[model samples]
Target: MNVLLGLSASNGIGIGKAFVVPESEKRVISSKKIKAEDKPKQLERFERSLAKVTGQIASQLDAVKGDKVQSEIFETYFLMLNDPEFLGDVRKSFEASNHSIEYILNQKTEDYADRLRSSGNAYLSERAEDICDIFGRVLNDLLDFHPFDIEQVPDDAVIIAKSMAPSDTVILSKRRIAGIALTDGGVSSHVGILARNYGIPAVFDIENILDEIKTDALVIVDGTSGEVIESPDGVALSYYQNKITKAKEHADKLKVFRDKPAKSADGESFQLMANIGTVDEARVAMEEGADGIGLFRTEFLFMSEANHAMGAVHSKVAAFSEENQFNAYKRVLETMRGKPVTIRTLDAGGDKIISSLDVQHSSSEEKNPLMGLRAIRLTLANPSLLRTQLRALYRASVFGNLKIMIPLVTSVEQVEEVLAFAEKVRDELKSENIPFDENVPIGVMIETAAAAMISDCLAKVSDFFSIGTNDLTQYTIGVDRENALVAPLYDEFHLAVLRLLHKTIKAAEAEGIPVSVCGEMASRTESVMVLAGMGVRTLSMSPKLITSVKELLSKMSIDELKAISSKRLNSL
Candidate 1:
């Protein structure tokens, strides 16, 4: 048996035909080169090439048939193909340089890949491989090369590629694929996220796996421990097979709790909701017994645009509403159809760059953008953009159980302003004789200290409050969670942050408005117990964590939780 040794980086395993990276010549251009007149033609060629490649991928998706995971991969590519900034950059680079399209595209891709890798942001760095992979495939498609067939790969093979794009990962169906080993990528990459979603084993950043591992090698990927054993002896093979069996058994146990209610031993029932970004995720959440979608991050629909346009923004919302109108909303409504799917409006700002915003003339380049103008503050300032999103949410409400949520609301006035704007949209729709639900519940994300402190007042006007503890803890403790330098200070267990959470939950309780926690903290086993004691009525988190949280709740008594909370609070 062919054998190769490497590390397993993700949970699932795959064995498949290897898509080796093809060699290409890198062309370089000097600034002193003549021919300014040739710029437009080069740009036109580049745009046309991109459009053609997108068309090809779409055609490929149409032809392939397997599973949702595979379909998502193709859909992600379609989104990238239509990305305004991606295409616009290609055009800009071509116009400014006197290099061949191949040279320019490769150079740009490499530069971006390097920047992402070096930036220390796992998500951005992982996406770098995707950028290169997508561009390379697009270029190859332009050159009349047929991409690999998804249906023909052997059922139990691991796919070894130089790198993988988000689109490439999306197109793969989970049933056929087992594990993934890549020469490039990291934990935060698109491939990594996709792998996790698919529940497949993956190992990334193994720089030379493509050159070392032979095709059809019998490799065992251990995702939990990040190990890869190649061409194992019978003893080792038996060991892995037994390990996989045990893991499956554990997963099966979790699945048993999928349909059970999340209730504390003392009989306090709380909604276990899911935080989702797309329609595909909506399906998964419903399958996993999520009460409702707590955070429907609408930003994914807007991020493709380098310059956020009102018309484009409206269309994206319309499309999301239209495509998902029947199923996405219907699933939540049917599951708890009459209950609420609290959709948080776009929280754009900080590190999330809105391509259309003019940042050159801003007062100061924010030294720390994450804590800067973001969420409701940024949205309120951009009235037109905010209005477009509000209109979409208002329109979507007619289809099923929907609620409007404003992110990062610090004051009563900000909440009132958003409510007023939402009312305007509802009135306009009514005037137009458009079908909609005018009385959709409005809520606020209590993420900042100001928002949490005055949550009682805000709760009076709003229907509910979702505690965004991720930001709350970050701001409360004055520590950036992403900054390793002060990571130890980023503890959610800090008495100040816990007390603030308790205060916010109590405030919402006093006002008779339901409260929930929708952050990383809500998903933690230990944190769930604390939140229960704090009187949180809901816990919204990643769907994968739902079963465990529910199981944990089933084992714990509310009285015990309250006792712990009382002791913790007294110590403070």
Candidate 2:
């Protein structure tokens, strides 16, 4: 048997015939050099070529029988082909180079690939390869050669690629292929994540997997251990077969917790909510028995190039909370609807800055972005962005239990500013005869020492408090979480951090504002009891952690938690 060997790298299982786009053949052409007169013709030619290539890929995907993966893969490619940025880049390059459409496209792809390969950053290098692969496939379609259709691959063939994009990986049929081996990719790449989600055995960043592994090789991929055995002996094959079986069984067991209530053993209940970024995730959260969405990051809505929030924004937001049986906000008006979905409005700044907003706001690379204006500070500075978000939230409120929570509030004044802006937006909506819940409660995320220290004052003014322990710990300990040298000092369990948390919880309790811990610490079993003892009633975390946290909660009591909280406070 032809043997293929490479590290089990990506996040999934299954395989297909590899579609390799040679990186050396890629070229980049500068867009600035093209004469203005030739721009329109070049763009027209580029667009036609793109459409033709997309059509060819679509046709090939349609020819594949019973291959669900292949279908998803082509669909994503279609999305990318239609993406404004991709098309715009082609046009820009054509305009600058004053070259023929093919030359411009080829040069652009090559330039991108070359820059990526030469970059010191490994992640950028892999991303560059994905770009080349995508454009190369498009180019191949335009050139009349179908780049290795999925229907052409024999069943049980393993795909070998110089690199794979996440979108490309998603389209492969999971049942047909044995596994995947990449010549280049990283653990954090989109392809890797998609692989994990699909439970397909994958290995990435294998230095020469493509060179070593031939087509139709019966290579054994050990995803759990990141190992690949070439033409494995009977002993290794048997071991992997057993492992695959066990993994499937374990997955089934995890699914059992889906519909069950996430209550602790001692009958003390803590809300288990999902942190989601999209409407798709919201559906998954409901299926997973999430009490509500703990965090619906709104940045995803603003990801498009358009400054205006999309037209479907309200409908999309409503879908998450409205029409659901356990809508928390309606059940407990003070909280959010069917399992309250607490939303932090556009927490941009730091690494989350978008280029579009940066250009409008004239945001330069800050010497210390972490310490600079960000989150609430940035929003407060640009009231227009803040107002737009408030309007969207107000419009979305009529659909379900929607609560607004402000991030990085360092003082009472900041809280006042956000509230003032929110109230202003509410009034405008009312004047416009728009329906909105005027009493929709607002909360503050206790992420900074300033916010934590004055939690009592903030609690009195706000409806609730969510302890953002991740930033709280980092800010209190005066250590950057991303700084490798001082990362060890970014401990959540530090006495100062613990004390601040205890103080914030006490302040919230004194003011009678319900408190929840909605950070990474909420997922930690060791920290749960302490948070519970500190009188925190809710914990919001990733959906994957819900069942495990529920299992832990089922074993603890409020009284015990309170005692632990007291002990920690006294010792501190």
TM-score per model over all chains: 0.75, 0.69
Clashes of each: 25, 52
Alpha-carbon lDDT of model 1: 0.68
Model 1 residue 403 lDDT score: 80
Tens-digit lDDT string for candidate 1 (1-572): 43444444566543334433432334233344437887667667666877787777666566543344354445445555666665667668877777666666667778767865565443344446656767877666444556564444456666767666565554455346677777666565666766776777887656567666667667766665666555667887787778778767888999988999988877788899999765557767888888888888765545433112222422122223333333444454445455567777767666454433322212124545566677777777767667766666666676678887899888999988888888888788789887777678898899989888887789889998898998899888888655435665888888988888888988988888888899998898778877787677699999888998988888889888877667667765
Off by over 4 Å in 2: 1-44, 50-160, 172-179, 201-203, 211-225, 229-240, 250-260, 303-337, 348-378, 447-461, 467-507, 524-536, 555-572
Instruction: Evaluate model 1: give its TM-score.
Output: 0.75
1-572: candidate 2 lDDT, tens digit per residue:
23444445553334334433333433343335556686676566566777676676556555652333344344434444555655677777666655566666777777766765564334445546656767876665444444444344445656566765543553444345566667766654666655665556787656766566665455766565666556667776676678778766866776777777766557766677777654456666676677887777665444422212122221012112222312322332223335577778777665354433332441223545567767887877767667777776777677777778898888888888788888888889888998887877899889989898888788878998888898888778888654435656788888888988988888987888878888988988879878877777788887766776776777777777778777777876
